[model samples]
Target: MQLSCPLPKFDFDVITLGHGSGGLLTHRLLQKGVFDILGNEFLGQQHDGASFHMDGKLAFSTDSFVVHPIFFPGGSIGDLAINGTVNDLAMCGAQPQYLSLSFILEEGLKTDEFSQILADIKTAADKAGVKIVTGDTKVVEKGKGDKLFINTSGIGTVHPGAAIHHQHIRPGDRVIISGNIATHGMAIMSVREGLEFETSIISDTVALNHTVYTLVNRFGKGIKFLRDPTRGGVASVLNEVAELTELGVDLVQSRVPVEEQVEAACEMLGLDPLYVANEGIFLAIVSEDIAAPFLQALKEDELGVNAAEIGVVSVNHPRKVIMESRIGGSRVVSYLTGEQLPRIC
Candidate 1:
C-alpha cells in the first residue's frame, strides 16, 4: 500500500525540543518536508548510511559553516556550505558528485526561514550538479546554538590525467588568480558595520568546480596546483605554497585584480586586501609551457573575466612571498598574524 499521510499543521511556527526527539515529529519532518524537497535515488534508499561505487581515486572533504549573520549581502550560509565543500574537492582536481549535510539548528528558528535555507541548498546543489545523498538535523536549545550551523562532507573522483597537488609546483611556474580579490571580505564587513559604498560590495560566493573541471579537461597535469583562497586570502595561500615547494612567489600590485571600491575600503580601514578573505576566488600554479593558453581559458568564463597572471614563482627568496608595489617598491608579504575576519566560511 502507498503511504498517503498528509502533513499536519504544527501549533508552533518555530522549532522546538520535539523536533529533535526522533519520534513522531521527526518522522513527520522527514516524510512531509525534507523528503519531498530533496529526494533522490541514494536518499530514497533510506539506509542508515549511503553506499556508492567509485572506480579510481576518491577525494573527500568536509567543512563546517559558522559565519556570523547567517544571511549576507550576496549569499546565505546555505550556499556557502555547498559551494565551499564543492570547491575543496575541486581543488584536488576532482569532480564533486555526492554530499552529506548535517544541520545544527537552534530551537527558536522559524520554519519559514528553515525552508528558505533548504531552498537555497537545493539551488546550489543543482547548479553544482551534485546530489545530497544523506543528511541529519538536530535542534539545539535556543541560546546554546546559533540560529544554524551546517557541516557538509563531499565526495568526488579525481580526474585521471590531473596531477594537481602542491608537490607538483616548481620554480618558474606562473601564478594566476581566477578573478578579483578581497570582494568577499569587504562585502561582509560592509554589512556588519553598516558602511555604505558608492557601489554595493556583494560577496564572491560562487562554485568553481565546473570551471576547474573544464580546465583540467583541457590541460590535465599541466596545471600544477589549485587552491581556493578562503580564510587568509591570497597572502596565506602563496605563503603556504612557497613553503611547500621551497620557492618564492613574486606578485605585482598592478597585475593583481582588485575592485576599485575594495581598494578604497581597504585603504580606509587600514586593511590590506591581500590579507582579506575570498569565497569565490582560486589561484592556479601552471607550468611555463601551458601558462598562456590556460590564462586565456580562465578569462573566457564569466566568473573569471578579470583573471590575471599576478605573479611567478622564483628562487630569489626561498619559501617567501614578495610583492612589487605599483610605485616599484618590493617588500615581504607576511601572513596576517591575527584573525582579520572571524567566523567567515
Candidate 2:
C-alpha cells in the first residue's frame, strides 16, 4: 500500500549542491521533504544519531543500494534498500524493529522522484515492521553519482531459540529454498534490455522477516543455517556453505523451482537460473527430521508459497556442490566466477 503521508510543499524542483550544504536548503529539504514523509517519534527527536533501548541478543546489519536506473518491475531502489537490510537481519533469526536510512543524491535528481522514493521507503518499513529512526542526506554533482543511492542499517532482537550457524550443518540436513529463484535478476535485466516476453517477469523484492521469524520460532535449532542468495545467486551461496563446513551439497536439477516465464527469459538471455540473483527468497539448511515440516510451514506463509527442498548436505564430495540432472547425470555447481549481473541488489 502507498504511504498515507504525502510530500510537503517545496520550493525546489531539483536537487542542487546547495541542498547538501547543511544550510537553509538542507534544512528545508529535511524539514519538508523527509521529515514530513517518514517522521516518527524516534525520528522526530532530530538528533545527529538515533538512540533506542532493546533487551537480549541483538543483530545489526548495514547494506548500500546502488541499483542502476533505481526503478524496476515490481519495486524501486527505495523499497529494495529497506528490504535488503531487513532480510539481512531476518536471516540471522531476528525480529527487525528499527532502521537508519541514508541517501546520496545527484544534483539533477527531481524532487518528485525523491519524494516518491521516500514514500516507498516508508511503505516498505511499515510492511517489515521497522521504523526509520535516523538518516542523513547528501547531494553530489550530476556526473559524480547515480540518480540516487541508499544505505540502510538495521537492528533487531534475536530469537531466544535461534541457533543459526554453519557449524551446526550436518550430512543429513536438507537444503530448502523459500521460493522461486531468478525472478529479481531477470526483472532488472528485462528493463535494461527492453525485452518483452509473453508474460512480465516482476521482481520478488518483498520482505521475509515475518515468514523467517515463524520458521525460527517453530524449528529453533533445527534450522542450522540460513542465507539469502543475492549477488551471486544460489550456486555461490551453496558453494560458500560447502567450503565453510567442508561438506557437500547435492542438488537435484529437476526439483529446483523456477517460473516458466523466468526460465524462458533465462534461456533467451543465455543465463543460468541458478546463477541469477533473488531478493525475496532464502536458502535454509535444516535437520532432516524437520525438513518436511519446514517446507510445509514455508509454503503456508505468504512469502514462501513456492518453497522447495532443492538439495541436501552430504559427505561425498567435500567442499563441492553437485547438481544431479533429471537424466541421472551429475555436475559440479561451482562458485560464481565472474559478475553475472552487476548492481543487482
Candidate 3:
C-alpha cells in the first residue's frame, strides 16, 4: 500500500545539528513530522521507551541497515529496515507485532528525502502488520555518516507449534528455499556498478512473517529449522547448519531457484550466486514426509511462489554441503571466507 498521508510543512528544508540537539528543533521535528506521521497508541505516549505486554513464548531481534544508495529498485532503506527485523523474527517462528525504529541522519540530509523514507517505513510496517511503537533520532555531521542509517528492534510472539532447532533436523530431512537467491544483492550491485539488464532486477525485500506463521501452525514439528539468508546467503546458512548438526547437505544445482537475469549478472560480475545476499527468501529444513506438502503449501503463498526443495540432509559427507551439478559433477560448498558484499542488508 502506498503512503496516503501527505508530507507536513517543515520550518527547515534540510536537517541540521539543531534538529538532533534534543531541544526546540527536535521537538518540532518530532511533533510536527515523525510523531505526526507515525503516531499510534503506544508511540503517542512519547516515552523514552515503550512498554507492552506479550504472553507465552517471545522472540526479539535487532538489526541495522546501511545499504548504499538508500533508495534502490523495488524498495528503499526505510522498508528494508522494517522488513529485515520482521523477517529475522519470522525465521525464529514468531509473529512479529511491534518494532522500535531509530534513525541516524546526516546533517545535510534533505528534509523531503527524509519525509519520503518515513512514509516508506510506515507503509512497510502496515503491510507487515507491525507497529512502530517508539524510537530515537540522531544526526551526525555530513561526510561523517552515510545519507541515512536505520536501526530496528522487533518483538514477536513465538508460534506455539514451533519446535525449530538443529536437533529436530535429521539425515533424511529436505532443504527448502522460499524463493530465488541473489536477487537483492544483484539489485544493489547493478545500481552501484552502473550495470544494466534487459529487465530491471528489483530487490526482493519483503516480510515473511505471515507465510512462516501459516507453515509453522500447519506442519508443527514437521518444520525442523528456519533461517533467512541475509548477509551470507544460502551457502553460509546451509554450511552453518551442517557444522551444528554434523549432517551432510546434498544440493542439486538445477533445483535451486535463480532468476535468469540475476544469474547472468552474477556471472558477468565474477560473483558466486551461492554467496550473494537475499533479502526476501528463507531456508527451511523439513522432515522427509512433510517436505512435499510443505513445498506445495509454500508455493500457494504469494511470497513463496518459487519455493523449491533445493537440497537434503544426509550422512554421506557429514558436516559438508555438496552441490551436484546439472552435468552430474559435485563440489563441496563451504562457509563464505570474507565479505562478498559490504553494507548490504
Candidate 4:
C-alpha cells in the first residue's frame, strides 16, 4: 500500500508590515533570511551591547542603519544608530564618549513615532555612557524616503597602554569571539516579508566600549586587532584581516557558537551564518599566550559568556580564511560577493 504525505503550508508569500512588528514574524524573517546570509559571534548573542575595558587614547568610528520598518524587537533605529557607532569605536579598543546623529525623515511620518524614537536614542546613550552632543534632522517629501533613516558618527578614547590594529595580527595568534552569531540579522530578517516564526527574535544592538575596556584592562598589549563584524559578518572580517596582514585565519566550524533555532532557520533558507550582519558583538585577536586568560575573562562578562577561541592565524594560504568543518573537511571562507541583505546596518 502507498501512503500519502502532506506538504508543509506557509501562511504568507511575501513581506508584510507585521514582519517588522517585533514579534513572531520578525523572528522568522531573521532566522530564514538574514541569519542564513550573515552569521557571526557578535550578531548571534542577541544582547544589548558588548562590554569590555581599555587603557586610555583616542578612537573613532561611524555607521548607518537603514532597517526597513525602522522599529523592531528590543530596539529601534534611534538606539540601533547610536549603538552601531558606539560599538564601532569600541572595536578599536576605545571607550565611546560622543556622537553625531543625522536623520532623513519622511514628510508623512508621525510626530509621535519620531518622539518615541528620540526617547529610545536617549535611553541607549545613557546606558552606553555616551552623549549625543550634536545632530541634524531633515525631512524629505512624501514617497522620497522610507519613514525614517539614520546615520551616526562616534568618537571615543582608547585605553592608554592599548594598541589595536589589523597589522598587529601574527601567525599563532588566537581569534576570540565575544558570543554567538546571527541574532541581529535574524532579528531584522524575522520582520521581513513572507517569512515568519513562532518565537520573537530581538536585535542585539548595543555599545561595546565597556566590554572592550574589560578585555584591554586584563590583556593589555597582548591584544592585537579588534573588529565588530557588522555588514559582512565574521567571514568578511576575517577575510579583510587576512588580506590586510597577508595571513590566513583557520577557524573551527564546531567551535563557533550559533543558536539552534538560528542554525535551523539558516539551513532551511540556504544561508551562511558567517556572512550575516551583527550589531552587538566583536572579535579580538590576541597573543597565543594570553588567549586562555582572555577567553576566561570574556566568559565572566554577561555579554560574552558564550565567548570562544574559534580560530587561529596561519602562515599558509596567505590572505585567506579557511574553516575546518565539523565533518573534518576544510573550505575557504571568502568575502561576501554582494549585499546579502541591504539596509541591514
State each model's CA lDDT, in order.
0.87, 0.92, 0.91, 0.77
Error of 1 at 319 (Å): 1.3
Quick one: ranking by TM-score, best first? 2, 3, 1, 4
Task: Please provide, for model 3 over 1-345, each residue's C-alpha lDDT reduced to its tens digit, 9 standing for 90 to 100.
Answer: 245766655667999988899999999999888877788998888899889888999999999999987888878899899999999999999999999999999999998888888988988899999999999999999999988999999999999999999898899999999999999999988777555455589999999999999999999989999999988889999999999999999999999999999999999888989999999999999999999999999999999999999999999999999999989999999998988788877
Note the residue pairs that clash in candidate 1: none
Taking all chains together, each candidate's TM-score versus the true structure is: 0.94, 0.97, 0.97, 0.82
lDDT of 2 at 73: 83
Show where candidate 3 strays beyond 4 Å. 1-5, 193-199
The true-versus-predicted C-alpha distance at residue 12 of model 3, in Å, is 1.4
lDDT of 2 by residue, 261-290 (tens): 999999998899999999999999999999
Candidate 1, residues 5-34, lDDT tens digits: the string is 332333458888788888888777777777
TM-score of model 2 (CA atoms):
0.97
Higher-scoring candidate on lDDT, 3 or 4? 3
Q: How close to the true structure is residue 142 of candidate 4, measured as C-alpha lDDT?
A: 71
Name the better of 1 and 2 by TM-score: 2
Q: Which ten residues in a row have the lowest lDDT in candidate 3?
A: 1-10
